[model samples]
Target: MPSESPCSGHADVEGKVGPESSGGPPTTLHSAPQNSPAMAQLLPSDVKMLLLMSRDPGRYSTVTRRLWGHIFDSLVVGSLERMALGVSQLMRPQALGPVIRATAMLYFHLCPRCTVQHYEAALDTFWRPPVKPPTLVFYSYDDPLCDTAHLQELLASWQQAGMPVWAQAWETSRHAAHLRQHPLEYRHALITFLGRLGLVAPTARL
Candidate 1:
């Protein structure tokens, strides 16, 4: 998990993304790619392994950013009166969802500049020199939060850059919930990757 502030932490089970192992070369597991470049810089010299799950590489491409901007604009527009009306009706169970959504949109509306800065940072991070660590990526084509095509493109770019990269794609799974949703498969993939990295014993089993 990343921190509420994207720049504050790396993606990990805790507030950061990478978890370090003890008494050996540190192994880092990164669940989010937005902070990968920062994590790369923070990694110990001996840390040479990474695991990327459902990476969001900062919407690096222009088309993606523009598309998302258009979508955001479409969803976040309405009169203040309408917003107040929506909020006033939130006492009704049926209006709760819309009110909650409205609140989120209002937040975004107030933080447009911050959002753009973060997006720019993410793009810059994505294009930074590739970390030398061998990487394993986990993604799903049907994940609603991560576009399959973008992830595929990222994977191809890493490979083309001569970074040792491996990827596993599933037909269906929730974003960042692959371990919970497909425990057996997730365990197998993780164990296999770790084994190859010599992080786990060959006989290791989940």
Candidate 2:
């Protein structure tokens, strides 16, 4: 339950392998069975926590990593209003600083361990070449928590491995705040990318 950064794009619940992403509109699916075998393997609890954290890092107490993990378990299963509060609080600097600091510490330390073992094990094996469903990676050069160079390296590796991926980089935008800073562009890019993949309806804007 360590405080996590805005990179909720990757879900590491229990450090277990879950599902492989696919180019399908999630809303259109009625159940897990419609997804690929790998996608269907995703843990419901983990996915819930991931979605919450991704949409809003403020959803849980990010001052401590362990507390964040617990929050992920509890709040994710909590009511909808609680989720809304989390996103709303993100605009308050006083409430966000501690969480951001904690997240930085977590990533600084976790990166090394993950690089030596996880990079070779999980990402390389589980998500092999020609990544299924394709991928759209969003990043910003101004993101404080993430290193652009390192992220580029990862993306390079993915592309070199023949994984199907599309990357978008912004000149300036806070970590995970792209959606807020440039709502129109963000939504357009997302819709366009997914639409191209046939995952989104032609008229969809979100």
Candidate 3:
């Protein structure tokens, strides 16, 4: 079967669209997706390979939970409340500042009860083991959004489960922007992976 890379996120799997090259036999290059692990959960049966770039696995690893929890809290509680809390903290006396600010930040923005149920439900649906396929991951240690340690752990789990997984990590780069930051290395990694899968000509150059 012809290989396919289905990129997904907020849109359902059936709605995913891949851009194809114009001059040659149709060749799909890329698509946008919100989360890699979540997308893997919904991959079409015919998809023989997966490529993930700078996305969380949607599992509640310690770091994943903390990062996503903060995001959910911010969305649910709103920015005005956060801003007010910040301003109020600055107005308070300096002697009690650190303790008061920490308390206020937690109270105003890190309250899990407000979003825990929804978060759990989402994770439950998105955290399933990926269907058997060779997987490639691109990530950076310095990305503030997606934790590198979490990816390492997740990749290890996948490998232990006997999944074929390959990863490339950089010390510094913008999230989802590795290609722009390290073009030759990124292209080499991608082409090398696809070539190994026999999805592209072994000598093909992007």
Candidate 4:
């Protein structure tokens, strides 16, 4: 059995989403029914690896950051900020032995089942959908991780779901390096987006 997060143990139980909170969106849960030959045909190896780890909780520490990093970087938004936030969330002591950390990471990568699903569900629940907040999604074509088609689909889903969304794509920038790569442009986007949300004056300077 996977160890539960320090704050809660109810995440990623068979059918539950998470504990009630004023947090973010409900996560899309996935269930795995043991090892099956058909799984090989149904999912790519990487997907299968994630699914397997999702079912187990012990792998959370090792896999959670990696998987999230991939997803965030692929989106090409503020990937660096996202990564930094991820590290801060760990909040563990440096005194913890490297042997322990390395062992945990190794097991997470090679473990037969996924235990990270609990963390995923918990993390997702940290961000609830805004009631009526204006939203902007910025993406980049040069981001190697995110597929343009998938990003379009995601934005379309948000729009169809009634989110006040503004989507923009850039021609160049490394993953999550948008602000650094194009400071003026990035500030403009933020200023425009915030103005739409009524959080700032249209002429405000950052």
Number of the top-ranking candidate, with lDDT as the measure: 1
The local distance difference test score of model 1 is 0.43
Off by over 4 Å in 1: 1-24, 32-106
Give per-candidate clash totals: 7, 4, 0, 18
After TM-score superposition, what is the CA distance of residue 201 in candidate 3 from its true location, in Å? Answer: 1.4
Per-candidate local distance difference test? 0.43, 0.40, 0.42, 0.41
Write candidate 1's Cα lDDT for 6-75 as tens digits. 4323333232223222223343444332211122322211111111212332321222222110000001
Per-model TM-score versus the true fold: 0.54, 0.44, 0.48, 0.45
Candidate ranking under TM-score, highest first, comes to 1, 3, 4, 2
lDDT (C-alpha) at residue 69 in model 1: 8
Cα error, residue 150 of model 3, in Å, equals: 1.5
| Best-fitting candidate, scored by TM-score | 1
Decoy 4 TM-score against native: 0.45
Off by over 4 Å in 4: 1-132
- Between candidates 1 and 3, name the one with more favorable lDDT: 1
lDDT tens digits, residues 2-109, model 2? 443333224444232222221222321111111111111222333433333343444332311222111000011111232223333333565675664455344435
For all predictions, the C-alpha RMSD in Å is 12.7, 14.8, 13.3, 14.2
Candidate 1 residue 84 Cα shift, in angstroms, is 21
lDDT per residue for candidate 3 within 167-197, as digits (tens), equals 7778876544577889998888788777766
